[model samples]
Target: KEDYNRNRPHSSLGNITPNEFAMKIAMEKQAA
Candidate 1:
């Protein structure tokens, strides 16, 4: 369960998952 939350890919964000999506968003914000 913990692994899934930390490493699983989600479908809503182009199949990137929650963790990945958050990181991507953070990076984009930083770039902006």
Candidate 2:
């Protein structure tokens, strides 16, 4: 999880910061 959660480019968020990347996913799920 650490590898995916950090040290990598997040394609879904268009390569945003890792912490931001994870937050975006979380927010999207909560919205759903």
Candidate 3:
């Protein structure tokens, strides 16, 4: 389960893992 949640890249999320997507959003918000 840990591997699936953190290691897998989701097609719906532009082929990025959920952790990566969340980090990207966080960085964007900080930049804003």
Candidate 4:
């Protein structure tokens, strides 16, 4: 269950993996 939650792509986040989405958001914040 934990693995699935961390590894799955989400439709709400543009179909990217959760980790990828998180990293993307973090990068955006750093850029700002």
Report the C-alpha lDDT of model 3 over 1-32, residue by residue, as the tens digit. Answer: 99787889999899999999999999999999
Each model's total of backbone clashes: 1, 0, 0, 0
Put down candidate 1 lDDT per residue, 1-32, tens digits, no spaces: 98877677776678877888888999999999
lDDT of 4 by residue, 1-32 (tens): 98897799999889998999999999999999
CA lDDT, every model vs. true structure: 0.83, 0.79, 0.93, 0.92
Return the top candidate by TM-score.
Answer: 4
What range of 10 consecutive residues in model 4 has the weakest lDDT sum?
1-10
Give candidate 1's TM-score: 0.65
Clashing pairs in 2: none
Q: Candidates ranked by lDDT, best first?
A: 3, 4, 1, 2
Candidate number with the higher lDDT (2 or 4): 4
Task: Name the TM-score of candidate 3.
Answer: 0.77
- Candidate 1 stretches with Cα past 4 Å from truth are 1-6
Q: How far in Å is the alpha carbon of 14 misplaced in model 4?
A: 0.5
